[model samples]
Target: MSDEPMDAATPAGAEAAGLAPADRPIFFIHTPKTGGNTVISHFLAFLPVEQVFPPPPQLTLLDGDFATARERLPGLRFLHGHVRVTLTGLLPLERLRLVTFVRHPVRLVASHYLYFRHMPELPMHQAAKALGIADFLRRYPSYGTNPQTRYLTLALGLRRPGVHQEVSEQALAALEHFDFVGVTERMQDSLTALSEHYALPNFPPARLNEGKASRDEVEATEAVLRRDEFLMRLGADFLLRREAEERLEKWFATRRAAQARGALLQGLKGAAAMPWVAARAGDAALSFLEGWHPQGWVGEPRDGAQYWWTEDRARIVLASASGRGLRIGMHVVETLGFDPARIRVILGNRLLKTETAPAEPGAEVSFRIDAATFARHRRTAVIELAGPRSATFAELDPATADHRLRSFAVRRFTIEPLED
Candidate 1:
C-alpha cells in the first residue's frame, strides 16, 4: 500500500537467517508454462557452453544420473530443466542452490490449456480440444486444483491420488532452501533481483511460445462455463500462491531497494551524476507503481497480467501513458462462489457509480469511472471498487473444503488516455 519495499529486518530464508551460504551447483526447476524457457535460453546464452548441462534444445533436464551429466559436461555448475519438486532425495541438497518460478494457478492452467491444444506433437491435444474446460478440469485435477503442488511435493510424483501434510511440509522445507523462488508475473524484477543477489548478468528476456493460431483460448474457455468450478479446486493453490507471492514480494522489493542504493553509490563515482541517479530511480519507481493499476481490490494482480479478488474497499491507481487524461473503464465478472450483491464503485473517493448483478457463473458486471476524475490528478487517478460482502466456496457448495475469503472474478480492467 505504501510504495515502500518490504522491511529488510525479517528474514526470507536460510540466507537471511545467517546460515552458511552453500555455493553449490545451481539446480533450477523449469515448471511448465511459467516462462522458464526464456530463462533457460538466457542462461544458455550467458553460461559457458560446457557449463550448461545437456546444452540448449535439449534443455530443461538431463536423462540420467548427476554423475553421468557431470561426466558428459565437465565443469557444469548449473542443472536446470522442466524438473520435478521431489529432487531432495535424488540430489545433494546441501551442495545445490535451488530455484524455480510459479505462475498464478488460474493463469498457469489457462496457459497450459492454450499451449497444449496447439502442439500436435503432444498426444493430448485432440483429447484436450474435445474435453473443453469443465470436462478437462473434472477429468484432470491439474486444471482445477493444486496442480503445481504436485510438482512441488515429491509424494505426488509417486503417482498417488491424495495430498500429504508431511510431503507438503517437506516440499515447503525444500523451498526454504532455494536461493530464489520467482513468480512469473514479476519476471523482469525477479531476474534483476537474482542478478543483483548472485552477481549474474541481467538483461531483457524474450517472451516465449505464444502457441498455434488455432482455436482462441478465451473463446474455448468461455464456451464451457468452468470458472467457478475451476476455482473450487484452486483453494489450496491460491493459498500456496499467496504464500509464494508474499515471500517473493519481500525478496524483490528488498533487492530492488538495495540495487537502487548500489546504483546511486556507483553513480556518485561517475556512473552518472546524483541528480541523474535520482531521476533514474524515480522513473523506475513510477513505472513499478503504474504497473499495479487495475489490480484486484484486495492486493496486486496475481501475475500483474490478470485478475484481482474484490475487497470491501479497493483502490485502482492509474497513470496515463502519454501524461494526458484517461477515460477509465472496468469490467467485473461474477465470481459465483456465492450469490452476487450490489457493489459501489468510486473514483478517487470523489465520484461514484454502482452496479448489482446475480452471482451466477460467468456473470457479467461492469461500470465506468468518469473521466472527469482525471481532472484532479492531471494524468493519474485511483479508482475504488467495493462489495457488500465477500464470497467463499463453503457458502457456494456446502461440501467445499475451502474457507478462505474471496470475491468476484475480473475478466478485464483497463484505462486508456482520452484522445484529443
Candidate 2:
C-alpha cells in the first residue's frame, strides 16, 4: 500500500532472526497460469540477474543438467521454474525457502487450456485448437488430472497417483511444509502476506497472460480434478492462517507503539504538506506500469528514435496536471497487420477515446485527457491502451528467438499540458 521503496540492506525483522531473506536460497515453484508470471517477475526485480538460476526466457533448470549448473553458479540465491516439487531434492532443502501458488482446479485447467490455444509456441496449442474441451481433457490426462496434487505429491518423491476422491496425506503434508503457498483467488492478500513473510518489496499486482474459457467447457473437467480441488482448499486455508498471523503481528506492533500521539502529529503534518507534494509529483513523465517488457528498447536506435513494444493490453501511468488537461502524442511504427491499428484508450474504467494509427510507419496519433477525469483519479491517471492483437517475432518468422507476445511498436510518446 505504501509507495515508499523498501530498503534491501535492512530487511525488516531479518537481523533479529539471524537470517535475512537474501541469506537463504529461495526456490519458487511456478505452477502455470496461476499468476506465477506476476509473482516471479516482481521477485526477480529485487535480486541480481546472475544470482537467479536459469534466468528469464529459460523457465527451469530441469531443462539442463541442473546439478552441474548449480555447482558452477556459486552465487545462486534464487531458483525458479515450472518444476515439480520432487525435482527440488536436487538442491539443498535445509537452506531453501520454498514458495508456490495454487489456483482453483477448475479455473486453473480452464485458463491453461485457453492459454495453450492462444500461444502457438506451446506444444499443446495444436491439440487445444484441434480438439474440443471434452476431448482435450479426455486425451490429455496429464493436464486434466490433479496437476497441483501431482506436483505437490512429488515433494515426497512419490510417483504421481491417479485422481482420487480425496487428496493424499503425504501430498497434503508436503503442501503444509512450504515456506509460503499463496492462493491466486486472494492474490492481493496473498502478495501482502508474501511480502511480510519474505521481507520483499510489495509490488502492486500485475495481471499478465490472462485468458478466459467458458464455464461449460471448464466445468466438465472438474470431475477428473477432484484431488486438486481438495488441495486448493488446503492452500486457501493455509493462506488465510498466514494472513491472520500477519494481522495479529501488526496489531501487536501498533499496540506497543509508545509514540502514538507523536505519530498522529507527524501524520497530520504530512497530510498538510500533501498539496505541495502532489504539485511536485505532477511533473513526472508517464511510466509503463504493466503489460510492457522491462527492456524498453530492442535492437539499435534509429534517427534518434527509440521504440518500445506494448503487450495486447498495456497500462501507462501519468501524474495529473494542475487545472489543465494533458495533450498526448504517440508514434506507432507497426500495426497488427491492419491498415489502421485500432486503439482503445481508457481512463480508469471510462472509455476516454478511440483512435487509429495509419499503416504507414511512424504514424503519429494524438489524444487529450480532460482535467476533470484527472481530478477524479486524485493526482494520478492510469491510462490503459487496448490494442487489436499481439504476436511474437517467432510467430511471424521461424528463425527468430523472441517469444514475447507484443503489439503496437511505439516509436515515441509525448505529454504536455493543454492550454485552457
Candidate 3:
C-alpha cells in the first residue's frame, strides 16, 4: 500500500499546527520566571511577526502604559512583558481577558537566584557573600518587594516575605482584578486552557536552567523550602488547594469591582459637571459617588427623612438627623480608605483629630464634626476608618451591625480651590 496522508478528519489525531486566522492578537504580560519564555516561544510560532514585540531592555518595565501604547499601535495585541497588570491599562474593563501563571515561591526564588548569578552586571554573588542560608532565609521577604516580586506573589498567591517585602497590599489588590490565574505547577493543563482560549496550536515545553548543581546543592536549596515558615504561611494563606481556589475566585470578583471603581475615578480629568451628573443619575450612584464629589448632594429619603448636606467647603459636614441615615452612611463608605494627607480635619481655627464616633450594632450614632479642625484644614478632610472592627455604615446590617465601631481619624487635607 502506498504511504498516504494520514486521515485529516480523524478525531483522535493531533490538531493542525498554528492558530486560526480569525483569532485576535493576544496581549501577554509575561511576568518573569513564570514560564514566560515558554509562553512567548509558543506564541511566536503561531502569531505574526509584527504581533510579537520583545520586552523592553528593563525587562521589568514595559515600553509605555498599555492604554496609550495600544492607541498609538492600533491592531496591537499580544503583549509579553515582565510588567505589572496595573501598569498595562490597555485592556478596557469589558475587553480585558487576563491570564497569568505563578510558581511555588521557593522554586521561583531559586530560579531567579541562578539567573542573576550568571549576569556579570548584577552583584548577586556580592549580595549573597555575607548572607548564608539562614541569612538568606531571613531576608526572603525582600524577594517579593518590588514590582517584579509583587507581580509574582499576587499572581501565584505566594506571600513569602523575602529580604524583599512580598507584594504590597495595593499591588495584590490590582492582581486580583484578573479573569484567569494559571498555576505554574500545572503548566501543561494551564497551557492547554490558554491554547483553547486564544485558539493556538501546541504549547511548547518549559525551558529549564541548564546549569548543573550537585545533589547536595539541590538538597540544600530545597531545604530552604521546608524550613521557611513564611513560605509555609504563604501557601496556607493563599489556600491554593481546590477548595481555596473557590475562595480566591470570590475574592477576585470583589477586587475587580473595587478596581473598576478606582479606574473610573482616576479617569476623570476635570470638575466636569455633566459627567458627574450622569454618574449620579445611574443606579447605585450614591455608592459610586461616595467620597468622590467635592460638593455633596442630598440622596433619596430613607427611614423618615431625606439625606442632605449640612455644611459647605468652608465648614463641611454631612448629616442624616433622621430617616435611615443612608446619605451619611454612604459618605462614610467613600471616605473610609482615603489617605489622610489628602484631607485635613479642623474645628473652626483649631485642628481636631478626625475621629469616628462608634455606634452599637443596628443603632444609628450621630456623626459630629469639629468646626475648628474643618477650618484649619480649610473644610477638606479625607475620612478613613482604620482597625479591624470599624464597619462602614453601609456594611451595617442586623447581622454585622454589632461589629461597627469608630476606628481612625483623617488628618491630612488636599485643598483644591473652586475654579473661577
Candidate 4:
C-alpha cells in the first residue's frame, strides 16, 4: 500500500482495498481539539456531503434526528462528529471502523483554557473564561486527567459510579477496538499508521481549533498541577498515546526493512495480524516490548519505544505455543542517564548471550540466543538482564525530580519460532 494517504476527494483508497466506499462506514470519534477538524475536511472530500451525519456545526454533538439523517442520506458511510460511538443502516460494528486522535494532557488542558478564553460564544466557554484554569478544573477535573478515557468508554452511556482507576482500565480496554488511533504530536506518523489500515488522503489538517499558549503560561499551569494527580489523570491517555506511537514507529521500521529485503507484503501482513498490539489486555504475544512481567518494569511508557527498565536484574516471562528450537532475541539501548554497559542475559543458568549497549542513542543492541540454548526453555523462561550502572529519573534531571530508579529500557524482545 502507498504510504501517502488516500485523496479524500476520490474513492481510490476504498477501491484499492476492494471495499465499497458507499456501504463501508467509518466512524470518527472526534475528541475535542485533537486535530480532528483537519481529518473531517479530508473525510468530506470522498464522502458525499449528505452521506455525512447531521451537518457538523461549531458544536457537533447535538443529539437529534440521527434516525432521520440515516433515512434521508442514501450511501452514508463516513460520519464525523462530537457524538459518542455509534452507527446505523444495517452496518454492524465490524463493518464500521472507529478512529480518533489524542493529545498530551497538559498541552490539551492548556489549549482548552486558551480556546475557552478566546471563544466565548458557547455558554460553558464563556463561563470557563470567567473562571481561571485552576477554578475551571475544580469544576471539570476530567480535562487534566483521562478526558479521552471518558469520551471513548462512556460515550452513549450514563456514567456508573466508579473511581478514576476503574474508569481508566475500562477505557484502556475499550481503546483496543478502534481500527486506527492517532496522536496529535506525531501527525504525519499517525497518518502513516492510519494509511496502513485505510486509504487516507495526503491532505494535512488545516490545523483547526488549535490554540497557542506561551511557554510561561503552560509552565505556570503545569507548576500548579500536583504531580501524582496529574499522572493519575493522564494515565489512560498516556498509555493510549504510547501505543499509537509504538505502532507508528514499528510500521515505519517494518516498511523500511521490507523495502530493503524486497518483501513489503510480509511486513504489511505482520501489522495486519496485530492491529491492536498494545491495546490487548490478554496474555497473548503481540508487540516487541509486550509480554514482560508487569510489576518489575518502570512505570509509564518511556519515549516512542517502550522497554522494561532493568539494572542488575529484570525477569520477563513469555508464553509460546509448543515448538522446538525457537530462537530468542531482544533489543536494548542505554538509558538516558547511564553509561553504556554490557547486558548479561541468562535463561535458567544458560547464558543465552551478553550484548554491549549501543554507543549512541538511536543505535541499539540486538542479540539472540543460539537455537540449542533457546530450545531448552522454548515453552517459558525467566529471562534476566544485568548492567553495571543505573540511575533514577530524579538523578537524571533535577528539574523533573521523579524518585523512581531507572535503567536501560528494552525496545524489542522476540522469540522467533519455526513453522513446521
RMSD of each: 15.4, 18.3, 19.4, 13.0
Candidates ranked, most accurate by TM-score first: 4, 1, 2, 3
- Shift in Å, residue 308, candidate 2: 56
Model 3 scores what on Cα lDDT? 0.41
Q: Where does model 4 exceed 4 Å of error?
A: 1-23, 45-48, 55-61, 72-74, 84-92, 156-165, 212-219, 263-420
Q: Lowest lDDT 10-mer window, candidate 1?
A: 277-286
The candidate that achieves the highest TM-score relative to the unseen native structure: 4
Which RMSD does model 4 reach against the true structure? 13.0
TM-score of 2: 0.46
Per-candidate TM equals: 0.54, 0.46, 0.42, 0.55
Comparing 1 and 4 by TM-score, which wins?
4
| lDDT, residue 79, model 1 | 76
Cα error, residue 227 of model 2, in Å, equals 15
Candidate 1's displacement at residue 406, Å, is 22
lDDT of 3 by residue, 1-420 (tens): 546653221111112322232343344556666676666666666667555554332334344545554553445556556655444234332233445666565666655655454455766655544565446546655552243445544433345344333334533443454445565666666666667555668746645324344556656765675564535434422433232244344444444444444433333323232222221211112122222222322355343222222111212222111111111222232233533223334333444344343332112222334444334433322232222233444364665554323333321221121112
Predicted structure 1, TM vs. truth: 0.54
Cα lDDT for residue 416, candidate 2: 71
Q: lDDT by residue for model 1 over 1-420, one digit each (tens)?
A: 466543221124334445455344666767787878777765765888777775766754544655565455336667777764455455544445667776787777776776667777887788677776677766776555566666655421343336323234433543554567777787877777667667788867855545454456655664454467666665555666666788777676545544444444444345554422101211120112111223443356455345555534444444432344433334455544453445555654454644445432244454443345444454344455566677565777779876655555555544443445
Q: Which residue pairs collide in model 4, if any?
A: 5-200, 5-201, 6-200, 6-201, 8-46, 145-233
Cα lDDT for residue 412, model 4?
60
